[model samples]
Target: MDTKKNIENISLLKEKMSDWRKLSDEELFLAVKEFEKMPRLEVSIYYQDLFNDPKFSKTLLDIYNKHKDNTKLVVLLVSAIGNMIQRYDLPESKEIYEFMLENSDKSKIGPYVAIFLPRLKNFESYDKKWEYFMNIKKMSPKKVAESSFETIMDLYLEKIPEHYKTEAIQYFNKKVEESNNEYGKQYYQDIINKIKS
Candidate 1:
């Protein structure tokens, strides 16, 4: 880790992030990017906490618009959108989620978007997101797992009709059998348990 970045991270995290609204959008983006040094799970919470002020929503949207084609940056943008949705329940997330599906692949930020898309009211049913997940299936196992498996499996287990739920389990089981990766098998099994119980 770069010591400069580490120091910057410590300084930023030390402050009350809600006060970060005073910072310009570029500064805010820098702060958000500083989170790259963190464990993946923590980044979203930091985003949620810091960017809660609705003023920053447009900042995030603008950043995402400008860098959507940059694969490295897009992950952070997707996490920011997910963070906002998780923390504030913002109503306008359909477009951000749509952008994720359009620009991201199945094995990358695609799974994260697949998971969150249903949270918006328009996706009360699972079909649209499900179709998108399948489209990304052409990616490698690691990629598909990264892109769709985690999110879509959870979606079926929680929200879909009973028949569809069983179907998802079966579908995942098939994938597990086809997969050479033991980790993927265990993952599918874990998902099966989550859905069943």
Candidate 2:
């Protein structure tokens, strides 16, 4: 594949994202998928450029403001922003997190929010992180359980605060016991042992 051309094409696609109303649904969907798969760092740079472009960001925000029914577009935006925050280690992640917190229920964007929370260095103290996890647990039990395991493992390895570390381990153990999958249980047990040491 011609990576340079792909990058340019991706940039071109993003340039038109604000004019999504002008494109057919199929075209918009394909374009969003293409942009989504671009190298994460590249996508972050793309968004940084877009954010810097007053015309583009204003137009994009206007479209989002007007098209409240366009759930797909909302998802794409949330996913893109979340990826940008995670991949770029952007300083603006807190702003994106705040945006997601405010708009999450309106767009059913909780999963993307969940994914973003773990990336924030100081996210451990945020009540929104727990709420995000609870929202996921209510809406997608399996995914919440799985992510809980992953998050706890990460916290243990990262050596988070003692209280939070205890909470993570307890949450993981609870979910592992409740989970039906034998492999999930074994994986949780292994991680629990790893954490203890």
Candidate 3:
């Protein structure tokens, strides 16, 4: 049951998605257009449900490709992809992770990619997965180290490929030593110790 909603009107879209779960496919497309215009926090609140639907995912991905320079929308899109990756764990999401790597910034959506990419597994090698994490190193040192450390523990706990765990630890440790951000270093040390024990 689609409504005669104008997709270009952001406020109307948000109002319509006050109960987002009940939206029709056509209405959802409009909601996605609205979400593309939303702040990250609002998008995060709303898109969690949308990411569960494969159709919304593909649509959001298409929107993602369309908005390369639109950092806000891209972050929301990558977050949607990451949330879907975390929630569903289906299909090859290496491309999504790669997109995050190439397009997302550390101060922005990079942390999401840093943390989430380790969770995805494909039929083939995780060369791209590791490459994404390694690419995070080029971002602000303290933040990358701090954020990635958590994902390292997640990898260790998830038992995602023995070699992958090894690589995550090595990268995490290197960043910890290099970063002057003491809080980040302490946080990393705290989590790493917990994972070790």
- Candidate 1 lDDT over 49-143, as tens digits, reads 34444455555566667655565566666665665565545445556656655654545556556545545566555355555554444454456
CA lDDT of each candidate?
0.57, 0.58, 0.54
lDDT, candidate 2, equals 0.58
lDDT of 2 by residue, 50-106 (tens): 334445434444555555466667566666556654664444434455556655444
Better of 1 and 2 by lDDT: 2
Question: What lDDT does candidate 3 reach at residue 56?
Answer: 47
lDDT of 2 at 144: 43
**Model 2 Cα shift for residue 181 (angstroms):** 8.6
Which ranges in model 3 have alpha carbons more than 4 Å from their true place? Answer: 1-50, 88-98, 104-107, 128-138, 141-145, 157-197
- Model 3 lDDT on a 0 to 1 scale: 0.54
Quick one: best TM-score, which candidate? 2
The best candidate in terms of lDDT: 2
Candidate 3, TM-score vs. the true structure? 0.50
TM-score of each: 0.56, 0.63, 0.50
After TM-score superposition, what is the CA distance of residue 130 in candidate 1 from its true location, in Å? 2.7
Off by over 4 Å in 2: 24-30, 39-63, 89-95, 103-108, 121-128, 156-171, 174-186, 194-197
